[model samples]
Target: MFGEDSPEFSLRIFGDIGMHGDSKSDHSKANFSFGSLDFVISGSMGERLTFFSESLIEGEHADAIFFDQERAWVAWNEGDSFYLQLGMDNSVISRWNRLYNHGRWLETTITRPFLATFEDQGGVLPMHFQGLEIGGLLAPAAGDLEWVAIIANGRGADIEDRQRVHDDNTSKSFSTSLTFTPSSMEALTFGAAALTDIIPADLNSAVRNGSISEQIYDAYFTWLGEQLEWIGEYAWVIHHDGVSGSNFSHRLIYLQMAMPLDDWTPYTRFDLKVMDQNDPYFVPVDQDLDQWQQLLGVRHELTASSAIKLEIGFGHGQDRDAGGAVSSDDFISAALQISWTF
Candidate 1:
């Protein structure tokens, strides 16, 4: 504990050593990497207002480090029923993304689900936003209902670009999510979310001569029992090409389960993504293909603030070449990671 004028600060460090082999290369490589140095600063203003920020320094080596501001927000709350937040934050379209955030030490596995991966990490969805978030809770006779709505700048031409300071177009993006938990089964929860946005075509050739209309819908459920934990989610993405009058639908799904035994927890997960090859929005980004991965992992707690994880993954996918020819690829990977916080 600190004085009233002092702010709380914490740091988290993650590192991993891993090896991977793929059919295309027919070889394996092993390396030790620095995952990230996460810094968190948080404080409060009076009783109803509070603020917090998270930043990360990440790279494979010291010579090529990168800095990222993951979240910065000021929030106002009224008991447990309502709250308003403003600043940079994670998008709530995916439950896993909102739950785990940037703290790798809080997760049970070494890698995230495909749907929860960040855009810069070869993911297809927008995971962060800069703007406002409004949320609240309602208590019913049998259960509780939670809801959130967000307004922010739409994504830029490239998937990795977040448009943190400005917007490319006049239209803003909007999204909403709802979840319900029943009193009869306190460990079970379910939710759904949707988002709509328009991506301008000014500097992007992928959309031809017009803007792209994008919509996403997701449904998910989680069951956390005394002995077992299970989570599942499915998402559908629709992209409409204004120039060609074409619409493409993409699908993503994953299911994960974990069991805790003493100080060790073992987990398994399956992830799948299917895309339309002809969707221009995905072609330029090299995401217009089908992929699936299976993972098995176990976590061992070394101390209250530290843990070690071992994971092995098997993946298969189809890729399209410059000449519009498609080929299949397969890969296997394994990693050992030690994560800690202080």
Candidate 2:
């Protein structure tokens, strides 16, 4: 799909093969499986607005139609100093494996963080939302500074109807982030964000009191070096519910370095994640978990419009013997991915 007369679109298909010598989950041995296919389509309306939609279809059902996200909006570009986008769209609040660019830079074989997904993990949080977003270049500080603000239906796209505007009091939520790029280092960018909402326990009714939520502080810095890219972030969440409390914090660090030699770019990564359990609002888990992963990836550019990527990873978890662990000793996986645009 290329244009409005034809339907502009893109696709990404991937598969993973792995051999495991562990004592954990089922299918611990060698296995081969398709990951997911990302399909997207867009159509332009004159020079001011556009319609865009994207979806993730997995396995044999890849041909099936399951709407993941669809947004139609109008945008105005009044010179280079400012731009405005208005309509139902994805939230511009935080950065995670899925929210930030696409799914290409992940160093792990599986996918992304469990908490960063759109699924329900004991009814905690939803991944995406419907809202009005406006962001653009703010000024020329030492180099460049960008600003973004969003005010949307506090409820995520998946649970929009479940939100009670009157009783829940979480009918709306707002978020914003400011990014700065120093003139000295063109490859480095840093930013901060804040989010607040009136969350609900379930979709029973629209009004659920005392279910409000807040995430006070979050910031990150990314550096794209000559032969490397590094990213680090930290966040703290506080809830009114006593059981859930005062300080719930998390820290994440990921570094990816690649060397370009001819048609191939070989890369490796190191990631560390920690969550504090001593805070008053700490959510206890079945086990205290820490994960270490090592990955080796090769990217082959077949053409200007398409490329292939092969990646392998070795993952290890801390204190595997004491408590029941998800993966036993260690796990390894290999994946082949193809991406293209039209």
Per-residue alpha-carbon lDDT of candidate 2 for residues 50-97, written as tens digits (9 for 90 to 100): 566555554422233343333445566554556677665554444552
Off by over 4 Å in 1: 1-28, 60-63, 202-207, 322-324
Q: Which pairs clash (backbone N, Cα, C closer than 3 Å) in model 1? A: none
Tens-digit lDDT track of model 1 for 138-249: 9997899999999999787667778889998899999999999999999999999999999777453634657889999999999999799999999999999888899999
Candidate 1, residue 130: Cα displacement in angstroms equals 0.8
Off by over 4 Å in 2: 1-24, 59-67, 70-72, 95-127, 155-169, 203-212, 239-247, 276-290, 318-333
TM-score (C-alpha) between model 2 and the true structure = 0.69
Q: Tell me the lDDT of model 2 at 116.
A: 41
Best by TM-score: 1
In order of appearance, the predictions have TM-scores of: 0.91, 0.69
